[model samples]
Target chain A: MKNATGIWALLLGLTLAEVALAYPSLAPAVFLLVLLALSVGKSALIIAFFMHLRFASRALTLALFPILIALILLLLGFLPDAQRVMHAA
Target chain B: MTRNETTWEGGGSPFAIGAKPLGMWLFVVSDALTFSTMLMVYTYSRLANPHWPAPFAFSPSIVQATVMTFVLLSSSLTMVWAVDAMKRDDRRKTVQYLSATMFLGIVFIVIHMREWVHLINDEHITLTANPWNQPLFGATFFGLTGLHMAHVTIGVVYLGIVALGTRMGKFKTDHVETSGLYWHFVDLVWMFIFPMVYLMSVKR
Candidate 1:
């Protein structure tokens, strides 16, 4: 119970930081990086604690880890193609 | 009270996580991939057109989306508390927490709907091309967020049924725990969507 409350506080702090970064004056590129990084931070906390992965065994963690890696790789693979199209036109 | 017996006690679950929870975890992973694909396409569309219109700025959608995020996050907290209450065999508190979670789920859906109405009616956005000529803008925005909203809607109904079952003394900790898994997964997805969709679109 105490831990859940602590996690909620941490999540809220991350959220506030994100809101601050969203201000129109902030550079879009910097905002994008910080916002996404904070998002990953927030997601890690939720997946680790809220989803009970923190206490889960290696078998469970190992099962889901590869999918995450593959999806990220897929994103990288798709990026340059989109950028190339943008550059051409 | 007799605890539920599992066939996996012998061999299937070497780690002893049990079949039901394991099944739930697998479902969550697959669902995560489904959203990831949609988000990937959204990223593709956003980058494909650097002039991709960000209609969220100068509108109420950002504020509304932030509120929705909080409502969903609060729902997630209630969901975990529901699981905790059930683990303690406190039926009343479990029902209370589940009900609160359901209410928050409904609140989230309502807020999102209002934002959509504002975008469509006042902002003149649609699933087709908006006045901005960024056709994919409305398409991806509504597509991804709509998918997540559907999940939230189903989650509300799912939690409602479970909450009712708990009120009638028809469920146990197992039910609440699984629901907690689903609810948290939904919240986790929104944590990504909130920044990816709303904040990133805010004009600079």
Candidate 2:
């Protein structure tokens, strides 16, 4: 409802930027970090604007996101094991 | 009891939104966790396998994926506009926007399947193996994108039903909004998948 066209434009620009960034030979870690940050930005815009989460109640937002983020972080804890495996290989 | 009843016994909506939309939001939350787990698995697999392949070339794969992203994003914008039209009680405009959204979704799926066929037929990438010799790349790539594609396919059918119901004076603004939530969620998932699956694997 808050003029999603602007948000759409921003999302498209971010996506294009991601493509252009991929063309460069950036370091793997740096490239990954930048891509993740840009993706988070795009997702935030989509959740806030298109999904109308921005108009949702603060209580609902609080009840929903924090726990979800925590669970996702917990899942991410397994990622370092992959690094260890890579080193061993 | 009336909706305005605000007793501690849960007589009213705590989230200040209707039950339907709230239910959809809960579903979105659960589904988000599912995708997150899959992505974690993908990242883990990629990192563990040092021979992970960045098989997608910019010519056909990345370019085609970019087009799919555009179509999906445009569908989301149209979905929100459909919700807006529904709120204004413009039933005709609502259906029109919804149809447009569905069309875009179909286009996205078509383009996506084309890319998949290219990979399978021309590039010899399957669910089990690929030219890169990293079987995990094919496994994770198809598993993730295939799951997301199924969602998009379901979403298109969901939007079709919502559109028909809205046109027949059955569904209301909340219904439109709920469907929009699902559509937008599908688009949001692509926001991550496009970059994680496609961009991160771009051929150097």
Candidate 3:
């Protein structure tokens, strides 16, 4: 809980790595995947450390993450259909 | 079990946190879904359009956004410090850290507005139309960033109120911690936004 500055530094470093990764001429899918993984890593650090969720009850974390992840997955499920409709048009 | 142990039937908080912070967590979940949907829509648009515009250049746009990210991350650190100070019952340092957080949030807003102006005026990228002729670019870019900026603006005001209340001996540790939760949520949203919207669209 006390390592706020350390967490902040890690977030900054990840951000810089994100930008550097963008500079490379990687494949689009690869670039997007890396960007997303790094972004998710940054978010996890912030949520766990900065928000003190790591110190919170396991019940709270359990109740929150599952629903959030499920909702995100539900939203993602529509992407293929969206593309299908666009292709038909 | 012992007297220290409580159960759901005993009318105790199963989450072991105050209602205020729990409420903030709920709000964070809802707000996160909103941003996630928007980002998904942006991704769909980007994938659908063959000529999606990558309008951000390295010199100004990316650099400005990186600085903004730094500012926001620094503000989150300040917010954490503020909450820590409040937990220790050092009201003076709590208010000081809160003030520092608010100042950094304002700095973030200023930088963001400047970037928006640069895009609108110099780059001719509006909410609906852009020189790229790929209108979804303008729409999604502005929509996501605009929503995030609005949150930052509101967070600054929210922190200001908390700081003033804490200074006047009105609010307590829970209040400061609750506000910090909101501020940290805002920072995390920007964590996703900076990469998806800005880094992905960086002009190569």
Give the number of the best model, judged by lDDT.
Answer: 2
Cα lDDT of model 3 by residue, B1-204, tens digit: 456655666567889998999999999999999999999888777656656788889979999999999999999998988998998999999999999999999999999999999999999998889987988888888899999999999999999999999999999999999999999999999998998888878897
Ranking by lDDT: 2, 3, 1
Worst 10 residues of 3 chain B by lDDT: B1-10
Residues B90-167, candidate 2, lDDT per residue (tens digit)? 999999999999999999999999999999998899988887788888888899999999999999999999999999
Candidate 1 residue-wise lDDT, A1-89, digit = tens: 78988898899878877887787566444665687789889988988888788988887898877877687777657755777777788
In candidate 3, stretches whose alpha carbon ends up further than 4 angstroms from where it belongs are A79-89, B1-6
- RMSD (Cα, Å) for all candidates, in order, is 3.6, 1.7, 2.6
Which segments of candidate 2 are over 4 A away from where they belong?
A: B1-7
Compared to the true structure, candidate 3 yields what TM-score?
0.94
- Tally clashing residue pairs in candidate 2: 0
Q: What ranking emerges by DockQ with the best candidate at the front?
A: 2, 3, 1
Query: Over the stretch A34-71, how does candidate 2's per-residue lDDT look in tens digits?
Result: 98899889999999888888988997899789999899
Taking the tens digit of each residue's C-alpha lDDT, what string does model 1 give over B65-118?
877888888888888899999989999999999999999999999999999898
Number of clashes found in candidate 1: 0
